[model samples]
Target: MNRYYWILGAFAALVVLLAVGLNLNPREVPSPLVGKPAPAFRLAVLGQADKTIGPEDMKGKVWLLNVWASWCVSCRQEHPVLVDFSRRGNGTPIVGLNYKELRGDGAIDMRRVPAEQEVPMALERAAGWLKEHGDPYLLTAMDIDGRVGIDYGVYGVPETYVIDKAGIIRMKHTGPVSPQVLNEKILPLVAELNK
Candidate 1:
């Protein structure tokens, strides 16, 4: 019957849509912030209470804003790549945005700590982690309350942003920065942006 043919066609269309969706990479989720000005925030530098830094401080330079946390397992995976990049001293400074360091650590949950002591406790943990894992940041800023992360439209930890000399966000990598991603996508963009 004609009605049977219409139902079959609709089901086939739905199947095709689902198949197309499945082929898309989840990590390739497009960020709305790309091509926009990098959000501003002045937060205390990790392990340095007296110093605070923000995107404004890095104007006129192509820089990377890496969103990470001591608690992020994926952060650890991408850290070695960043460490090697920093060691190369390629002229692009990586400013770490230490996001939401309040949790992680079965022995002692930082979330249960007093509000006044939370930042300090988180800093201590982060500093220790960096010392052990190797720090790649020119200077890491503490986003204790995660307000800065929220402003930047962070979906989760381990996101990275490539900001141009003019402070516009040129590219946003939603997940860990592997060597392939660095060499193929990030480095090429940085080279072009610097020119």
Candidate 2:
């Protein structure tokens, strides 16, 4: 009887824990990297192979680092919001990290297929996509090998990080940035951090 009671108590505790976790927003999943210094990387510029950019270049400025890929459907959903934000000219630079993508069709996800011959093509495709869709980035960097993505702890494309002027990562949103999230969470935080 004592053993049975212990098992039941353990089961109830697991149920409570699961319930709490389920109630939390998936996008708001706490990252250990938050409040830490932003990961550093210097990658080739998307359009210009000779140029490179990274967090080091953006020091002393409050900025946004948006991780996106041409293959990510969610990135397309969030693009208009970012475009609008850029057009507003709020003085907050939006740096783009063009994550893993494949060649031939932009629909081919890099994670699903091994990318080797496709990288150069992917960069060309990305450049064309931005040209057609209207680029919102102050400068877009290419993470063709995805080492930079790993450094940033990117679980998926379309993640965004808001870095303060001091270069500390203040907020990380993992998913499409809808208008509601931009207005309710990101904008206010940026305003406060800038001050």
Task: Compose the digit string of candidate 2's lDDT tens values, residues 1-195.
Answer: 999999999999999999999998775667788899998888888877789997989889999999988778889999999999999999889999988665323556656755555667878878988887789999999887678888888886789999998889999999999999999989999999988
After superposition, the stretches of candidate 2 with alpha carbons farther than 4 Å from their true spots are 1-22, 26-28, 103-117
Task: Estimate, for each residue in 1-195, the C-alpha lDDT of model 1 and write its tens digit.
Answer: 999999999999999999999999986778899999999899999877789998999999999999998879899999999999999999889999988888533456655788899878889988998999999999999888788999998877899999999999999998899999999999999999999
Please, what is the TM-score per model?
0.87, 0.81
- Candidate 1 local lDDT, residue 114: 82
Q: List the residue pairs that clash in candidate 1.
A: none
Best by TM-score: 1
| Model 1: per-residue Cα lDDT at residue 138 | 91
| TM-score of candidate 1 relative to the true fold | 0.87
RMSD of each: 2.8, 4.7
